[model samples]
Target: MKATVYEGPRSVAVKEVPDARIERPTDVLVRITTTNICGSDLHMYEGRTDFEEGRIFGHENMGEVVAVGDGVDRVRVGDLVCLPFNISCGFCRNCEKGLTAFCLTTPDNPKMAGAAYGFADMGPYDGGQAELLRVPYGDHNCLVLPEEARERQSDYVMLSDIFPTGWHATQLACVQPGDTVVIYGAGPVGLMAALSATLKSASKIMVVDRHPDRLALAEEIGAIPIDDSKVSPVDQVNEQTDGLGADRGCECVGYQAHDPQGHEHPNLTLNNLVQSVKFTGTIGVVGVFIPQDPGSPDKLYKEGEIAFDYGLLWFKGQTIGNGQANIKAYNRQLCGLIQAGKAKPSWIVSHELPLDKAPEGYQHFDARDNGWTKVLMHPDGGSHN
Candidate 1:
């Protein structure tokens, strides 16, 4: 098998690796067809995280099941399935409560409650950025796709992560049908939040970001794009809401939030969300915030502490929700929307390349290069495309 392996800071290589096979009775072997290079993957790619070299690098995955373990009763060989980024044991307490992202039984370390494929500090599970993926808890982790998924891999592939994560942001923010919502960042997850807000009938959707390409995509989806590079995002959001601020807010940039000058400020988006959301409004954060950043120049960020405006947050009486999205919690409903032709997340995809081109895709995406909104890799060398 061949996989995209993390080489070092801003580097990756696609090369032959040991084949992934069923290691347990509950495991399922998938012939990976479509996998995405997610924004979060950049954390490892940029050496911001302690991701080990030689580890595969993908989580957004969907493909055909080539083999299934005896214990897998629901998923079968030949079934097309989408594997959620989270590697959870469905019978765990957290998973039973639909908090699969924080499943207590998956992580190798007892202190860590959640696990993800190919993610640093998550678990030992290999990712599906290759020709084969060994899925644990097959019946529980695999979301069997409809027959049409074979042709709509790009859209369905999103079910593995971003789409559900975006929807989870809306849920955390408690976005009401007529509520006005503002989201920070215009990356894939942010755009998905905007899309989720739209589907939930948000009266007004405002997305704050500096990237012209990303902001343009938000505008195309009927969201009012607030170019923070040109003006104060808080002011724009306030002005659009007639000085009341948005009814709900979402933070999608996480610890990598920074200014136009390229100076990283981990607290930037949190403070912005506090100011842009109205008093008493709620905010949902789906961005990836690590516990530590040893390479950070900022003292507070080095310790994974942000000097957030907690005083103002409390004064405003705003409710804040932050965590990883439990992909299993929303994938089914989101998948239904896709199957019904109501959602098309594939609109965000800007690059489709074969598995061998993964390093190029990572380079362009990690640079945040213009026009690279999302990159989807076909492990079968464009056969799925």
Candidate 2:
């Protein structure tokens, strides 16, 4: 099998690797059809994380189950399924409470509660960015897609990560119908958050980013685009909200956030959100923040720490919810919306290439190239116009 292997900083290669097969009684062998290169994947691609060489590099995946272990009863061969980024065992205490992202059973490190395929420090599971993927705890992890899944593979595939994650951001921010919401970052996740907020009937949605293409996507979906590169985002939000600030805010640009001049600031979005959201309003942060960044030039970020305006956060009495998204918590409902033609997250997809072209996709996306908002790879020679 050919898989995209991480070679080093800002590099990847498609090389022949040993076939991925069922390794346990609870495992399912999936013939991957569609997989995504995520923003979080860029963290590893840029060598910001401790992701080792020779590891596969995809987490958002969907495919047809080609084989299943005897223990897998619900999933069957030929069933189209989307695998959640989080690898969870259904019987864990956290799984019972719908906190599957923090499942206790998948990670080898007892101190780490969650596990993800092909992610650094997550677990030993390989990702689905190849012809085959070995899915652990098959029945629990595979999300069976509806019959029309093949026709909507691009949209359905998003249920694996960004769609649910964006919805999670809205959930964390406590976005209510008719509430005004402001989102920082117009990347895929930020655009999805705007879509989620729109579906939830938010009276006003504002998205901030420097990229004109990304901000245009947000505006396409009824969100007001704030070009932070041209104006202070906080001032724009305050101006739009009549100086009361937005009722809710979301931080989608994790630690890799930067100014228009390309200087990295791990705490930029957090501090900005604190000022943009009204007092007593809620904020949700779904951006990936690392525990350590040995490659960081900033001393505090080297220790995986950020210095944001916590004093003002406390004084404003604003509440914040932060963590990786519990994808399983919202995937089903989001999937339903897709099946019903109510939501089409595939609108954010900018490129679809064959598996061999993954390295190019990674290069363009890592550079944040114009028109490269999202990239989906098809291992079986699939293509979308």
**How many steric overlaps does candidate 2 have?**
0
Worst 10 residues of 1 by lDDT: 376-385
Off by over 4 Å in 1: 383-385
Model 2 agreement with the true structure over 1-385: per-residue lDDT tens digits: 9999999999999999999998899999999999999999999999999899999989999999999998999999999999999999989999999999999999999999999999999998898889999999999999999989888889999999999999999999999999999999999899999999999999999999999999999999999999988999999999999999999999999998998788889999999999999999999999999899988877899999989899999999999999999899999999999999999999999999999999899999998899999999999997633
**Residue 331 lDDT (model 1):** 97
Off by over 4 Å in 2: none
RMSD, candidate 1, Å? 0.8
Give the clashing pairs for model 1: none
lDDT tens digits, residue span 1-385, model 1: 9999998999899989999998899999999999999999998999999999889999999999999888889988899999999999999899999999999998999999989989999999898899999999999999999998899999999999999999999999999999999999999999999999999999999999999999999999899999888999999998999999999999999999989889999999999999999999999999999899998877998999989999999999999999999999999999999999999999999999999999899989988999999999999886453
Cα RMSDs, all models: 0.8, 0.8
